[model samples]
Target: MKSIDTEKINVGVVGLGLMGTSLIVSLLIAGHKVKAIAPIPEDMEDAPQRIREHLMICEDAGTLDRPVDCYLSQLVISEDYLLLAPCDLVLECVIEIPEIKRSVYKKVEAIISTDAILASNTSAIPISELQKGLFAPQRFLGIHWAEPSYFTRFMEITCGAQTDAVLAEWVYELAHQWGKEPTLLRKDIRGFVTNRLMYAVYREGLSIVAKGDATFEDVDKAFRYDVGSWITLMGIFRRLDYLGLKDAFETYNRLAPHFCNDEQIPPLMQNMVEKNAKGTRNCLGLYSYTPDEAKRWDEAFAAFNVDIYRLAAMYPSQREKKKTRV
Candidate 1:
């Protein structure tokens, strides 16, 4: 397939939740004409206002380069799939149900061009399965984004079993243009890379709490002080290399067996779900807080992540440093 060579491409985003909205805004910030579609009419109506508020946030944060109305002018919000017909790319950011995603993909495929890039924002779903029944599966791949996508630099680009290599590479280059430090997975894998690594870390962290070795607060503190210190500078393996890989190997050999090996959902999470615990959103979860306090904490976290994003930029990873020099 030929590469998407245009400086600005027409893109469509299906399922206009926070993710879809953030994506459209980010794409608009990068000068793309976006067609955003949400299932409900009310959500479509509010999408523009939500984007405007986000643009204001970006303006205050000094990230906005152009006027907010410019982005809104480039964006078209609708409930109809036909509006996506002119798109050069379409991203499916719907709920994480296989059948639901397949239905959306089928509908999107019917409306968009045969060669238009079709991507998913799935975190755990395997793209190989998501490509089933597509009119052109070769154009389908996974393009996962993290929360608050417009601000974060993390993106994961994955290829399905039948995905075209050239198209996948094209997406990789496009990701860089989107101002992302995206990892392109050569093979489609369940959980891809981020989720797998994060879950591994979660398993161990939860195991510690379950075993009563530490409280949840202690775990959070440990992460905030320990991993937070250098995670922006280098990843786990790179940090190991900095310390001494042989020493890390020895430590892993001694400690890996003790890490959580349970396949079943831990009671800590299951019980929380049963209780309808939703952290700050519902004022319940690992730690309880007053509603107003919880709201502040949530806002604090949102602002803190932005500041951390800046720190991550300043302490660019070794690869980033080398790339800049070259």
Candidate 2:
């Protein structure tokens, strides 16, 4: 296999929405040339400014080593798919509808080289399902990322039924260049690793609230104060080991029967959706927020991300520590 030169990589991002624009900054910070294609007119108009603002925040947080312009100069934001002809990798971050995503894939495949890898930023869709009808299905995979992509280290690289394993491993190496702790899933599954674990927690949390065992605020505090405290330093498996797994093993056996096994969506979430509550975007979430309060919360979350990024950096992964020793 040919080695990828990280410095010279030209990445194209389709769909210049929130995650798409944020992802460009990440690629730019890692010293890659980026071509951003906004499929919609609104995204084309808003993406540049949003990207600039995100970079400024990164600069303020000392994450961006050079001036924002230095990074901005590496970016080319447009509505033209032809501009993606030179991109070594292209990420599709459009809406989650299968039809919409497949349409974007058709246009992208027409432009990029056969060797160029095509990936999706899908959080819920199965990678194999999306790989269907693609001209080069072997080169297609899922490259899921968390929000505020530049600040977060989480990335999931998943392989579909037809995805080439060697190519998937290449993306694993590439993700490391982007400063991500990427997990490569050899087999495709809905929600992959992170979402599967998170959704389980959500199901249990919602079940408790619906059963009147605890209020949503109560559940939030437990998660924020308990799980939030040590999760950054150690994931769940490590936490179990740290606490002595014997007790955990016993507790799990005892509580297994009581766990929520509901297959249906929780009523709490259904009701919220019915009411058109879009959280901070509309200031109508589980907890009441005035317009001012909602804006403040949004600002606070962004600032908190920066702080958490710095904090997480202080504790490098075991893999990094092993490298340091070597």
Which is the leading candidate under lDDT?
2
Clashing pairs in 2: none
Which 10-residue span in candidate 1 carries the lowest summed lDDT? 1-10
lDDT of 2: 0.91
CA shift of 172, model 2, Å: 0.8
Give TM per candidate. 0.94, 0.95
Candidate 1 lDDT for residue 189: 78
Clashes in candidate 1: how many?
0
Q: Tell me, by TM-score, which candidate is best.
A: 2
Question: Against the true structure, what is every candidate's RMSD?
Answer: 2.0, 1.7
Where model 1 places Cα greater than 4 Å from the true spot, the runs are 1-6, 317-326
Query: Residue 220 deviation, candidate 2, in Å?
Result: 1.0
